[model samples]
Target: MLVALALLGVVCLALGGFSVRLLLEQRRQAALIAQQATQGAALELRLKELGKRLESYQRINVRMGEELGELRKQVANLPERLARLEQRDPASLSFSQAARLAGMGASAADLTQACGLSQAEADLVARLHRGRPQD
Candidate 1:
């Protein structure tokens, strides 16, 4: 009976040591899990912030695209507008024709109205080329 009791005591001591070692290992694993969880949470928050920034950039890109399209339309019509301006230019009139009209008794007002000359230009032509009567 005494030997059997000693063997049981030795077995209990062995089990107690194994339990303590197991508890220590569980504590280490739990600490590692907690650290990993904290990192995961931080990463999730960073991902959300990055997503918002990406959305803001996308909105800006869309607005820039719209402005680029408007600029393209203006550029497309530029040649036509320039051609119309060239057609309306009054500088195409020659000075000799204005002088000849003034010598034919045309008034300064007539020169301006009929020959595309400016008022000052018509007046100068009239002064230089007014008809002279034969003596």
Candidate 2:
């Protein structure tokens, strides 16, 4: 009976040691799990913020694309608009006026100042369009 009691005490001591080790391990594992959960939550928040920023960038890019398309359309119409403006400009009629004045015996200086012709342009028109001298 004394031997049996000693054996039982040894077994109980072993089991107590094992239970303490298991409890400490469980606590350590729980702490690690809690740390991992915190990290995961932080990462999730960062990802959501990045997604929102990406959406904002996409919206800005779309607006810029629309503005670029409008600019392209305006650029495309510039040449035709310039042509119309040139047609309506009074300077376009200067050469015809110079020639008519030349034909009516106007002097080179008169065409140059009156019709905005350069000296060379006035002299050429005077020579080309002047009337013949009366015989």
Predictions: Cα RMSD each: 16.6, 15.5
Give lDDT tens digits, candidate 2, residues 76-118.
Answer: 7654643443356555447666667877899999988998767
C-alpha local distance difference test of each model = 0.79, 0.79
Badly placed stretches (over 4 Å) of model 2 are 79-135
The whole-model C-alpha lDDT of candidate 2 against the native structure comes to 0.79
User: Which pairs clash (backbone N, Cα, C closer than 3 Å) in model 2?
Assistant: none
Q: Give a tens-digit lDDT track for model 1, residues 74-123.
A: 66765464345335653886556666787889899998888887887677
At residue 34, what lDDT does model 2 achieve? Answer: 100
Clashing pairs in 1: none
Considering summed lDDT, which 10 consecutive residues are worst modelled in model 1?
81-90
Q: Please report the candidate that would top TM-score against the real structure.
A: 1
Q: For each candidate, give its TM-score against the true structure.
A: 0.58, 0.57
